[model samples]
Target chain A: MTFLNRFAGLRLYAVLFVIFIYGPVLLLPLFSLDTGLYPTFPLKGLTLQHYAEMAANTSMIEALKNSLTVAVIVSALSTTVSIPAALALSRYRLPGAAAVLGFMSLPLLIPSIVIAVALLIILLKFLGVALSLWTVGAGHVLICIPFCMSVLMSRLEGFDPSLEEASRDLGCTGWQTFWRLTLPLAMPGVISSLLMGFVVSFDEFVIAFFLSGTQTTLPIFLFSQLRFPDKLPGVLALGSLILAGSAVLVVLAELLRRRGAKSANPGDI
Target chain B: MAGYGLLSPALLIMVAMLALPIAALVLLSFWRQSGYTLDTTLTGANYARIFGLSDSPTVWMGIPFYLAYPVPVILLIKSLMMSLTATVTVIPLAYPMAYFIAFRVRSGKSIWILLLTIPFWTSYLLRVFAWKIMLGYTGAINSGLMALGIIHHPLDALLYNSGAVTVVLAHSWVSFAVLPIYVSLEKIDRSLLEAASDLGDTRWQRFRRITLPLSMPGVIAAALMVFIPTVGDYVTPTLIGGSGGSMVGNLIQDLFMKRNNAPMGAAVAIVMMAVIALIALLFVWLTGYHKMRARRR
Candidate 1:
């Protein structure tokens, strides 16, 4: 009944929970290093051949380039557009803001597969738009916006609005007030929004899978590669690297957000 | 008006990409497809086939049944069943972690949350694919067992079934379940617990009365998060859930990609959305969650 033993059980459960989440993920690097192709547990001599093989693969490299290109553009585009809307939602007394937010967040509720199919129908059947990297990039932007908006919205809402009001009162034009006061204040959110958008667009698979015609994003490529058993090792090597990359990006974003939160309002964090 | 102006760019993008595309999907569903050329005729035949119009026995034995085109209905039920199982599993597992963070963790609260969710932001494809490596015939589990001299043959039964799909799904949504429940648990007033204890409420009693009810919103939110996504998930099932494990997602993919039936795929997609929304609403109603939210607002 005491505090110590009561939480001791919970602590143990927490440890097990971490293993459950990370266990499968960690298997990637472990197997990627294994000389054997299968991800079986028995220790095989370590090898870097898969990574080498991955480096040599032209299609894999192309997919990586395509994914990176899409992610960068998507991050910038989603964040840039989200700044105004996010600010509007957080700061303004706009009518139907809830409905706007609801509509944006609808993609989160509906299955990504369903969304992909919907977009596919639009591009191919209605618009007569040939499926290409352009369509994939468009899909990425759609999925990234809701996520980026939420990140920026939280950051915008987190700080004092009095500063913006004061700037406006001091005869600063609306645009000047936003540029001079609001944008800098919401810098952390903007950065976080960009990072969020990047991470989402980078790891995105379903939408790209449906929208892409001749070109393949890395995830779509990885998914197609999943069919071949021999392709698994290179897949593992690539998967491990991606997992590490995204993990780093996410941690960096978190650290920046925390630091930014502190700077935004002294002692608030 | 300025606010509207500020919002216009993001709003326009969503409308052009998300809203218009979905509207187009609905419109496409009403049209017929034949050999790469879409027939522009507006017809309800797709819906009819989906609802058993083409089939002679629309009402088999008492309830509406699809004698023909049974795959969508069957897979829809199965997908819902698996998602429900995964959602139910997620709550118990996620609640403890959320609770530990809410009540037990003294410092580094954000770090703990960050640690748990980092995996979520990573490649969902890789994460789902990991299960194939873990549970496949020559995957980690069977091979590990063999190395330990626990079993001789690799268990083919471990991979590619509803069982595999359910487990992967439950694992896949771990972060989504935890964060919301943690927020709800964190928001519980410390004073309420103390007041309940002063009134002779035991720890368990206090939790049952106050903590549980208050946290129901988060729990319900977690359930909806897990249930809704898993129902429409295509990756996990496709990777690990072979023929026996194929859900509505796979069928929709098949219809669109392989079967050359885009209109039918649209129909199935619409139907899936309708069913998912209906079930989610029903659950929220049953839990009185909407009333709770309105009252809170």
Candidate 2:
């Protein structure tokens, strides 16, 4: 009886915590479907008008395109850069490697707001470069490196170095062995890194806020809209779509990560 | 040689993207500039202005102090407090969930983990905005409460306050806290728990002495991970804090964007970084020292 009681209590607490975490996100879809301008309860009737209007907004569409373009470019660039870094760091020993890795990962610790402000001052003042989409892409690459490195490193670590060695011994060049063995083995990590990097760049706000000139990303567009409260229902509708998309991407990323881990070491799980 | 060549791109990118910007921030902090004009002569006036060392103490200290001081500090402190509260709230809840998943639940650990991570998929801003809609004056919570006859008047305090920000941000970040602690709990040797049971230790006694200490590292990491970023965050405060909930990040934002006072902004940003670094270093050092002392004992 006591055990059952305790289990019930535990389940209750867990459900409440889950509600706290996920309740607001769940509320967005409900409110988006709401008929009124204000996000009030007592739904007058369900309507898709807000979503349709959002779809038809030209500037919002442009912002979405800009965000997508930047995210894709940044993800591709960062993954390409992280691959060799991950490979060398995981596969071989080098001088100051720890320090290099630490430096590379330090951006994760520093607040993005600080980085954004710092970059703005530096890029405009010292380099005399005007803010542009390219600068925003550059900032995304900076922030995305640590995530790419960590994911790639985990994949690299689980891989057996002996496979590459065996391939090399079997009359294959180092380059050829890496292409055939390492690259194939690490593809899952590469894919996860690419997905995660894309999502992060797309969703990132502070960096894009500072670096984007004349071109507004979706997040910045959403932020600008928040000042006007009446437009909030429209924002909620837009937010619901973004939330659904991001959730799908995150799940895909996680699956890729698990797949990478599993393939790198078939014995572990 | 190929490996070195392969590594160069990332290194070069980091140098250009990160290191150069940081160097530029330092330079910009030392210069006196108005709008687009760059003064060739360097000065410490910005730092002086921030520190209230100038003759125009109002610009240096009074105005920003009055207008900007309370919001960011309060928001940072409130967020930190809320994170601590959430951490405490989560420990008891997560300890059992982790326990159930690790030792009790017979199958589908990966599914639960996936379920936990689902919330992270949505854009962070969108999630926060969702909370705004849910907690607003005419929002879901009050409507539900009023429908339930919990109160005649709607709870005006439900949104745009420190409490709302704290609750929502804590919800958003709970997964980060839970996952680390779960990993640590799973690592505990089952035999140790069984031995404690065999030795006739009460369940509570066994948990207090065995499970708790073993999981301290994860708890610490979880707390630090959530606490550090929450302290620096401005988004939650800006969205939910209304006029009262601005954080240090907001001040930095105003300095950069609204005010265009680069030096003052840089000074505030530097100070914010220094404060976080100091706190993080202190936490690590204290934890390390405690571990060493416990080892000696």
- Model 1: docking quality category: high
Error of 2 at A121 (Å): 1.3
Q: For model 1, how does the per-residue alpha-carbon lDDT over B54-125 read when each residue is reduced to its tens digit?
A: 446555226666457766887898899999999999999999899999999998898888988798789899
Question: Residues A74-133, candidate 1, lDDT per residue (tens digit)?
Answer: 999999999989888988898898999999898788899998999888887778899988
Worst 10 residues of 2 chain B by lDDT: B53-62
TM-score of chain B of 1: 0.95
| TM-scores, all models, native as reference | 0.96, 0.89
lDDT of 2 by residue, B1-297 (tens): 556676789989888878888777777777776776657578887656554432322232224333323443443455456656655655555566666666555677887778777776457788887777778887788887787888778889887766677776677777767777787788888899999999999989998999888877777777776777776676777788786555677777887788867776776677667767787779878878457336634
DockQ of 1: 0.87
Task: Report model 2's interface C-alpha RMSD after superposition on the true interface residues.
Answer: 1.9
Model 2: lDDT to the true structure: 0.78
RMSD of each: 2.2, 3.9
Which residue segments of model 1 deviate by more than 4 Å?
A: A262-269, B53-66
DockQ of each: 0.87, 0.60
Worst 10 residues of 1 chain A by lDDT: A260-269
